[model samples]
Target chain A: MKLHNPITLLLSLTALLLSQQSIAAPVEYIFINLWDEYVQQTPLPDPHPDIERRFLHPDINIDKPSVDQFTALFPVYDGLKIDTHNQLAIRYGVRQTPYRLVVEGKKVITREALIKAPLAAHADQPAQDQTLQTLSGHPFDPTRPGAGFRVLFFSDSLCPFQHIPNCERRIAQNNHLSANIDYPVITVIKPFYVDHTQVSAYQQRFNVNHEIVFDSHNQLFRRFEVTDLPYWVVQNRQGKVIYRANQVPPLPL
Target chain B: METIMKTNLKTFLTGIVLLALSATASAKPYPPLQARTLADQPISSSGKITYLKFWATWCAYCVEEMPLLQQAFENSQESYQVIAVNVGFNQTVKGVKTYLNRYGYRFPTVFDASGSITRQYRVTGTPQHILLDASGKEIYRSALLTDELRQHLATLTGDKL
Candidate 1:
């Protein structure tokens, strides 16, 4: 098998190996990477270059995804759409992603909050479908200290909003929002996305300073359901999606 | 004498207006770029179609329905070729390589360094399809390519433009 298509090769190998092993053994493992979720939340980061070099070195152990191995670990999910999975992680009666569901047959078995541990049974759906309150990942009082709004800024140093050739008005469209308003915006710096230089240039030119977070694994982007780049989601002082200019919905096809 | 003065003033105003109009007409709303590849190769000629589909490895829509595009490419490569350009100007070659390998996106991807092609084509989002003619003129544009479009392309190019 060609090394370029190692994912398909691994799947094929698993099938053959499983057939030879005892029936009691686990079937096979598929890592449903959610990098797409992260690409929309922040720009690529500094550690990306060193991490990327290790991925293409041809000597590293790629058996499992590790934080320092963003390049190789994420290829399994490259060019993949978000429709194959659901917004699995939910809080305050909301579901979110990084969700793993194990199925043996037609019946639903279990769903565990943990990814390392596979679930034995699927839990029943929640009774209440609608909760009037805004979305909050953590349960905290809105009036408490540091309990302000969370501005999930999905940007990439590589795909900066500036110099977007004018055709990509979305970048300017996302930038037009008045950030001088009330609560602060949490900017997630995703430097390793489509292009890092552009993102860097934009940050330098704009002189952005805010609640900056890093998503080396892209976990936070998937949580907010952002699809397109230069996306902005406004969570209230209570951490709810009050307004989002680029909230990517589920795939139609 | 007063009428002559008024006529000359009107003539001067008309000259100013004409110059302004001509200058604006010559200026490009989005000027063409001089982006060169790693080997200093100029950007390849965009195939004849009205709408050009620009996508990136980071764009989810571009990745998900990739196999469908491959099918389209295979079905009608002779008469019509869909150039799925990759916006890797800001991304590393290795990162983009991983993405291309993962999705099996084996199309003739033209790289955008200074975003000249993006501006020239007037593309705003990923997975956007522009249909151009034989002389490189845009005729149709859409954010998403539907099944009906695939069918229509099949009929238009006799294979699929």
Candidate 2:
């Protein structure tokens, strides 16, 4: 019964347990803040006195309802206060403020800032096997069951609205429909110079409600052969492109 | 005899786990970038500090900030290379040239017509500044032109702000 034997046994047991835990529990949630200043800003209008008090005093044990509501939607929310100084910010391509990116682990689950705009309502087509990450870092396979028809929106965040005013108007109209419609929309933001932060600001300004994804590397855009800003492609549950257009489609009565 | 074998096995497993963890902690290196200037000359980072400024003809902020970038570029003097990358999202080379001519500030300008370079750098807006160190690692970045940044650039280049 040498001391080395017991020490080695303990180390082995610890390593085995840790490895098992790592394999079992992937990082379920990551909430990245493109800009810390904007994240600190109140999203709610006319904050409750208790909430204000909590902000003033972090040491206070008082429960804030607003914070509780947000936490309820995301149990394990971790904010990455990113700036130009942060290397991760550059790595992730955060261009603007109030970028709320949710990831399950390595994959992006959804982006709060990207929204979809329907170009046309057409016959069913097969869905494409596009592996996108959700805001919560989950792998979102459009072909998966319950993923319904997806409205694939291809748009540039830095597209000059001055020259193409129609594009801007269409985006506004599409933003409205995406917010009100119950269909599954997947918006692919074409990376220009704009990052998640700028995209978040754009989403806020337009009040968009689609699962935004970044095509920063332009792999998806190239695959789709979309060169224009604010392009829309409709895909059926089976992952096939059915309809593609440059304008927003008319909503059914 | 069995206990001695178990101890060796455990030690080996622990070492493997530590190695895996260490590998994950290291940051990935920056990707290579190649582009042409407005003068049609090839400009790239050759293991020297590089400054990339993303701008656009339509962005008033970008237009206004061009002079500061020019000053920084001129003052840099062999210490660093400054590149004014025009984000050509719905823009033309003529428009960019007009703006450059009006400003008369000629520090190597590059056009991101297809937005490939912009996407690589992850620039989200105009007047975005990114500073890469000699090893091509991103050292600093900012979306705004501030006095503090000017001071920092001055210190890095040994030039008067």
Candidate 3:
């Protein structure tokens, strides 16, 4: 076998180089960090910096989201956008501060998954469907396509201030808003310090006409990444989020 | 026309005064805080006004304001006490230690590993400053370190900003 032929040697070297290059190629990532400046200042148990720092490689690009809306009821700073609806936060299902989303090619690896194992070998999987039930015991899936546009109204029966009458008024205002909306609105009661009985009582007290779902385990809250109460997410018939805001948006007349 | 202008100005001024009054009235008592310091020491309640600052290493503004905070902490030693609360989002105790050591910030820090203290205070974001009086009444809460805060500090510490 004449293995020393110039053409054969060149082909062999070229194959070896191609294989090495493929092995050495670094994966590129876009690191989207969704964080609040105030929350960053406030004392909270955040993700470990060491774990998060793994994404800060040369191949990873950092992207900081911009604030577009004035969301604070009482503006803390001249440009503070607290309570404002952030598109990236909603898109990534971010609930806590310093939330990291690593986008590599077509796969998006979450902080929780990235911290657990090696990112290079990890396979992208579809999100698990959470089992949800309505107050009437019927199975409810927010992702399932319905006939018309659906409104997810994340509400807390009692405000953080339980004693204040303004809390009641706020609940009434939300209920009224839901009643007026042309789209089918589903009221999801928060699981934090709230119970099914409180939701039922709230329905009666506020005369909430829409279907009320008690998120006993905060499954829906986690699914929607709802950080604040009185949050609204509008989804089209195809179950895609078209609009979301902390404050209810004016619907079509 | 001059009288009408004066009347309009009076209404606007009265509205501003009422708004200020309402703001003062709305200042609620500071919620009770329970947490351990960086040294794992439990915080003891004091009669002096408490200045709570929430900060994280990831927040550029929080890091930028650290020097000012340290200065305020040093100056207000007699009149008020400053507690730097590390909003532990994406931060570890060891990481916080390294940061403080690197910057030489000696202000007392509390690692909110559970974020309970922040939640109790309803802190929405970082660099949140809360000034509580001797009776634990929240006198001021703001995201930005305003001139008013500086004046208040100067008045209490007797050190002009």
DockQ, per model, reads 0.02, 0.01, 0.02
CA lDDT of each candidate?
A: 0.44, 0.57, 0.61
By lDDT, who's the top model here?
Answer: 3
lDDT of 2 by residue, B30-121 (tens): 67567888889998875878888887654534654666678888888778889888877435688678768876888998998766677677
| TM-score quality measure for candidate 1 | 0.32
Give each prediction's root-mean-square deviation over alpha carbons. Answer: 22.9, 24.2, 26.8
Task: Give residue A119's error in model 1 in angstroms.
Answer: 25
Model 2 misplaced regions, further than 4 Å = A1-253, B1-27
Top-down TM-score ranking: 3, 2, 1
True contacts kept of each: 0.00, 0.00, 0.02
Q: Each candidate's TM vs. the true structure?
A: 0.32, 0.35, 0.39
CA lDDT for candidate 3: 0.61
Candidate 1 deviation (Cα RMSD): 22.9
TM-score of 2: 0.35
- For candidate 1, the lDDT comes to 0.44
The better-scoring model by TM-score among 1 and 2 is 2
